[model samples]
Target: MAPTQYSQPERFRIALGPLLYYWPHATVLSFYAGIADSPVDRVYLGETVCTRRHEMRFAHWIEIAQMLREAGKQVVLSTPVLVESDTDIAVMRKICTQGDFLVEANDLGAVRCMERRPFIGGPHLNVYHADTLAWLAELGAVGCTVPVEMDGPTMLALSAARPAGVAVEAMVWGRMPLAFSARCFTARHFRLRKDACEFRCEGYPDGLVASTGEGQAFFTLNGIQTQSATCLDLCAEVSAMADGGIDYMRVSPHASGTGEAIAHLDEIRRAQRPASPSPVMPADATPSNGYWSGRPGIGWVAEEAGT
Candidate 1:
């Protein structure tokens, strides 16, 4: 597919996606305190994963948002991906009506609550085609974060057909969130009941790595969300993304090295040079960009190989 021409700023915005793992209350606060000075242009706050991992409450998130905003960063609150109960619905409603910051609607319920109000469509919405993008734009989606599984050609096609005034954002870094379940895998792994899971996920600040029978790293198990074992590093594709009409690039938060990742991307975006090897990956995790290359999600295709 040919690249599309869309109205975009001079530089592609760098966004920090919401925290996906549970952390200690002080750790969460310190993380954002560091992020307040990072190069990220936009920040997505709030708990998007399991609600049981509540080290920080809604009020604390708002306080952090205000602090980040004070630091001259755009702040957006993210709604939970799975609405399993009435309590979840009520929380989603609260996020949609918060009125202070922009909201990223991760589910249909959030979209409904945000009708006629501007929002950013979260990646879990599975908006693969232009029609779905337009439908969302009509319902007040100022931008849409395309699914992490979407390929480059598909993104270009969707960008070409996107409605006016709507922007496209893509996940450029971190482990891809593959699936979510009602059952808490982290809890189950520890042989605990879902209701009485004891918040064991807190122990894995970056999610527990699950290996295959042969002991190959496969997936990272959070409470309910299953993520890729390898982080997705698309810093090398920054130019291609800008050319393909992607306005924003999101970097998912890690327990550590998030600032370094942001700085690395900042350098690449500013210099418009080829990206160096990412410095933020944990010692055990490798980098993968297979989904961007139309390969297996776990596969890694080198930049030169793609060319």
Candidate 2:
């Protein structure tokens, strides 16, 4: 009832996506603790990246969602894109059965199962354009996370065709979640079996960065998923995204501090005229915004000197 601070009087929104890696339950709790007090309007909680990364279960996820709700944040449970087992479906069913919180279906199976339930169809679902969005909206998809590879113009065009009150979101900061695989890259790299790998991924706060043979930091090996090593900074590009009809902007949680990332995105959503400093590119990541420009996703063009 606080007038929905995010884009209420403005034109854009900021949201926190589901944790993409397997973090300890305590770390997850603490991260949301800070987010609940931050400037973000919507917060999504659930494990959608890997089914094996389990420090928290259905009960725990529900608890965390409750906590975020108590702190005045909207909560959503995200289903796995590649559900490989009965247990995976079971857990996803539990999340779907929660009924109260909104659900973000990441895969086709989830979409099919969530018939007429008014959920958020996640980016991993690969919805692009008016027909796809219209189809999803018909299935009770109230919102859809714009795929990371989509450019501002395309997203804007898609928004112009979506259903009424249906929202579009963009990833504004943090490691870009590029792809997911069935094999645990970290465990395999360490010469271990997927089931008995001791969950080595939990030790990495930001997931392991993998470079290409040409010495380029191409992606991150996070358990069974591969993420771009570079943090996607849509800060300078926010205006274009907003104009493109993006309703919600997303910031994925890195190991260090998620609050700052969320706050920075909040500033952009509020359309503050003054600019902010960009992320310091680490050796492993040459940050780029080319995806917003409609080129290759990794291709980034420098912003105007003042922008």
Candidate 3:
């Protein structure tokens, strides 16, 4: 195993990614209110999935950002991944123009729009190469969230010679975002049209799980995003990542146990060791870190004892 980097605790920040799944207004507000006191150093706000979700408007997101900022957490507003209409473009423009906090650019158009302003390159941006990362840095990107599919060695390779002042972040826990489409999958699951989804996704705070033919949990369906049914657990790999130049570990929000997850990661960072294999998962749960080891995304590679 590699040695841990960063002699200072402030160098490695923990981030809470934007809520990918839609929850009611009260639930969303309440989630962040509690998160305001979490051990996290950053909080990403805004709807990154379906644009039709109005439970929290731009103003509401701004309010949440301000609240988190006041609590001493760095706040970044994330843009939606699959922007479709003129309205989407308008909203993206509005977010980029906020000028108060950093914006996480989900679309290439967002990258083009945010030129000359420091921004966050979201995981959805497909930033796979050092050159691309450097280009984004040249465009004023100060940090980037590495895609879930990018493995440790690849991450090391990218970070080894990455542009100066550009920080690297990786998803350390939660359902891995696999893909996004123009179609509304959760609405389709309930036999509803995209235009009239009736907000079916609201019923599933985490996401609707789609299983295999053998009844094994497989994929998670959000409005338009397909995520891994099995939550990705890289808790055991945090030390290695820290050693490899990762500056941040992001915990994707779930309807339950988010705080506990953040607390556990903080504990691991402080102790600089592997956490006891995460609270026993469900029978159908398939926790994985193979992608981090350069294998198939769903496969788990166990660590040898006392590395």
Candidate 4:
């Protein structure tokens, strides 16, 4: 029998991605506890970067996951983007063994470790074409996140040709993750080795910013991952996403204003009106949707009167 073709939802679901910055254990726990009442449909857990900064242990993550699940939200454990050490591999293996909750495979190694358990293709995974999406689906990926660099036209094409049973998710709001490396940029900035550096990332509730020589904020350093200095606010693009057949919109958690951001997006989804004129940003963050509009990643082209 032929496979069932993928179907688009009338409205996109809001998913809360795993926390990227290191925060105090209590703060991390409290944040999710409050998220249980938020309008988010799915919540991703586990440390996705810099395992050295262990504010929440494996058990703590599981506990929070259970709490969110009980609150009627689907929970998915996210593996780190760069799996370098044996310890990282071990944790990835353990998370894959979690039968109750699904896993999001950020690294290709984690994809192999999942062993046919249906997983979500994390943003770190390179999924640029229909065949790549099909291959991942053959390996049991039920959903896949589009890379932040992929523009709307490209995404529209992929969404049209994606294999049956696979869904495409986009990062609708938050700082775009630009790149990941083995060296810890956060520790390096303090002139310390990655292993020996004190947990300084916890000091910045959100990741620290890196400004250019001319003093323009260019990127955010979250341990080893580099993120766009400007947050990608697609709050105004819900109708565009729905028209393109996008299945889900992943909202990366911020240090503050996450609930308000999700609420605004929820309002847009429920109303099904034209895109909003303004974009919202959390405290100390700027807005940009240039990449989605097929321009440079940092440019913020304002919407026209009717666009």
Top candidate on TM-score is 1
Selected candidate, larger lDDT, 2 vs 4: 4
- Candidate number with greatest lDDT: 1
Clashing pairs for predicted structure model 2, backbone only = 156-244, 290-299, 290-300
| Residue 229 displacement (Å), model 2 | 1.2
Taking all chains together, the TM-score of candidate 2 against the true structure is 0.91
Give the per-residue lDDT of model 3 (tens digit) for 174-242.
Answer: 889999988999999999999999999998888999989998878999999999998888876766677
Clashes counted in candidate 1 amount to 0
- Which candidate do you rate higher for lDDT, 2 or 3? 3
Candidate 1 lDDT (Cα, 0 to 1):
0.88
Model 1, range 160-253, lDDT digits (tens) per residue?
8999999899998898999999999999999999899999999998899999999999999999999999998887776678878888989999
Listed in order, each prediction's TM-score against the native is 0.94, 0.91, 0.93, 0.94
- What ranking emerges by lDDT with the best candidate at the front? 1, 3, 4, 2
Q: What is the alpha-carbon lDDT for the whole of candidate 3?
A: 0.84
Where does model 2 exceed 4 Å of error? 1-9, 275-286, 304-307
TM-score of model 3 vs. true structure: 0.93
Candidate 2 local lDDT, 1-307, one digit each (tens):
4533232235677789888877888988887788879887788887787777768887888888888899888888999877888978987787776788999998878887787888998999888778999989988899999888887778889988888978888787777778777788999989999889899988787888878899887778888888887777776666656766887878787776466656665665565443343544423455666787777667566662124
The residue-level lDDT of candidate 2 at 101 comes to 90
Which clashing pairs does model 4 show? none
- Which runs of model 3 end up more than 4 angstroms from their true locations? 1-11, 272-277, 280-284, 304-307
Model 4, residue 20: C-alpha shift (Å)? 0.3
